[model samples]
Target: MPKDYSLLSELADIFKGKAVPAKAEPGEVAIINLVDMTPLGIAYEALRTFAADTKTLSPYLLEAGDVLVASKGTQHKVAVFEGQEFPVVASANITVLRPKEGTNGHYLKFFLDSEEGRRQLKAADHGRAVMNINTKELSSIKIPNIQPVKQSYMAQRYVQGLADYKRKLARANQEWEKIQADIERQLFL
Candidate 1:
């Protein structure tokens, strides 16, 4: 199948994350720091929270369908923010990608996490003590121009597949444990 490529800038609003230095005591807002990024997704429960004044954070506050990409790291993990109970914002070491209406944020994340997508993003890597991806490079990166509906469908399947895989892996582990227990019992007998 022929693939169409579109610049990321054409599909999303690319911008850097906020640089709030200190977190207020008894934090009121959650920050998606680079440390919170994982291979699967952002660790919402483990995010650093700060008692930020909402008014000042309004611009940087993440929307429900916004996508996040770790900017300063060897692996630029990507995730779609599904919104949180408390207001959430991206940290300095992260980049916030607000998808245009034509693009699906989940699909964008799925593509960015794909092997080909990672290769494209690696072009932005400037070798140094710590690797970094600038907004300009990210904006210029080309993305597969799949229609929004198709992207949505693909994203759903990708998410469902991950869930199914995790469930099966856990069940396999349980089965293995049971077999191991029986083997130990037989050996003792």
Candidate 2:
């Protein structure tokens, strides 16, 4: 099928994350440091809470649908910020991409996770020790200008498929363990 495309900047607001250095306190908002980010999503287990007041970090605070992309290290690494009980924000080295009305956050993430998307992003990487992607370059990246209904359909299936795969994998592991146990019992007998 023929596909339409547009510059990412046209469909979303792309900006760098905050640089607050304070560690999160017990009950404050969680801070999504570069260390907390993963290839496909944010590592909630690795997130550190911010110690400062939420007001001080208001602008950097993330909403549930925001997409966070790495500006340093692995350039195309991205994560979706699914809001939790506590609030969250991205670190300075990451970029927060908030989709506008025309764009879908999940679809954007899926595209960025694709091989073509990674290739384009990596091709734009620059710097010595640590590679980086600036907002200018990141914004210029092309994305599919798909219809909202279509985008939503694809995104939902992609998410559901992942959940189904994980469920099947867990069931398979349980079956394997049962087989192993049965074999051991038979051998002992």
Candidate 3:
């Protein structure tokens, strides 16, 4: 039999104070936009350039396995960061949730994207036209308990699949470009 994971609220008490950093401009740090995120994962250019003066920005830095939740915009957009050189400077409308001890980032992300999680978000949300959940509410949101090892495995598999898909897509695009180039050469010459 599988172990019963505790409610997300059970683990909330262990987290420290939430951090809300200043927004990052172009060329400062890699930025994650709504368009850059998908159900499976984030897009290649999801992390774009930041402004030169972004160093002055607040605690907007993200680690390899940090969880990024869409705070102000659409209800369901969320993403997790993979390893990269520059840290991610997320948008103001987004909330970055860093897991505390005993909580796994991958498990939190997957749980939040689930049907139960969506319902909880919907219930916690205020505002009539544009539904939104603040950092406080988001922090209070419940998540199921999962083993850290299992979470790591799930994250690894998801990332691997996405990476493979991106590589294949890149190869296909290159092939198409070459075919187009050949046709243009024959026609022009």
Candidate 4:
């Protein structure tokens, strides 16, 4: 461990997600699964739902600034749960990390997504059949001990840049679709 780095356990409370039974109908609780997570971010549309009383699943219920890291998988995806209007919880495959008040949750997610952070996580992987990083190993991962304010500022800048890029990508995709439609019409004519 580097002198400047601190173990993630020192900064956050780690909790393994509970498996929730699924429901056929649209339900009150949203499940954040591995499929819901992506390199860009969590795919809100990919989230599955289950019927459950929030009171019973209180421990799994996501709070604002909670970081959800994939426990079992090759990617070991990391995402921040920004707290929704309704109830949401991570699925069994995810390990929820609740950073302390002074720690920036987004910064933790960003760090875990970085090359150095990914290397640490990869080194921690030990499961045989299904590659996984256990809670204990994840808790021991090292991260730079940065002030919350500074972490927040840096995270916000990265977020803003990403959002801007996404907007431009969407616009470009729309233009490409329009061109495709024009070509199809010309072929038919």
Which is the winner by lDDT between candidate 1 and candidate 3? 1
Candidate number with greatest lDDT: 4
Q: Which model is ahead, 2 or 4, in terms of lDDT?
A: 4
Candidate 4, poorest ten consecutive residues by summed lDDT: 17-26
Name the lDDT of candidate 4: 0.85
Let me know the TM-score candidate 2 reaches against the reference structure: 0.82
Point out the higher-scoring one by lDDT: 3 or 4.
Answer: 4
What RMSD, rounded to one decimal, does every model reach? 2.9, 3.0, 4.3, 2.0
Q: Which stretches of candidate 3 lie over 4 Å from their true place?
A: 1-27, 44-58, 174-189
Q: Tell how far residue 179 is off in model 4, in angstroms.
A: 0.7
Clashes of each: 0, 4, 9, 0
Q: After TM-score superposition, what is the CA distance of residue 106 in candidate 1 from its true location, in Å?
A: 2.1
144-171: candidate 4 lDDT, tens digit per residue = 8887788989889978997998999999
Among the numbered candidates, top TM-score falls to 4
Task: Show the lowest summed lDDT stretch of 10 residues, model 3.
Answer: 12-21
Off by over 4 Å in 4: 1-3, 22-25
Sorted on TM-score, best first, the list reads 4, 1, 2, 3
CA lDDT, candidate 4, residue 77: 84
What is candidate 1's CA lDDT for residue 166?
79
lDDT of 2 by residue, 1-189 (tens): 438788989888887888776643556777788778765467887777657778977788888778888888744477778878887878888889998996778888888888878877776677667878767888899987788899889878977887788799899999999999999999989
**Model 3 TM-score, all chains together:** 0.71
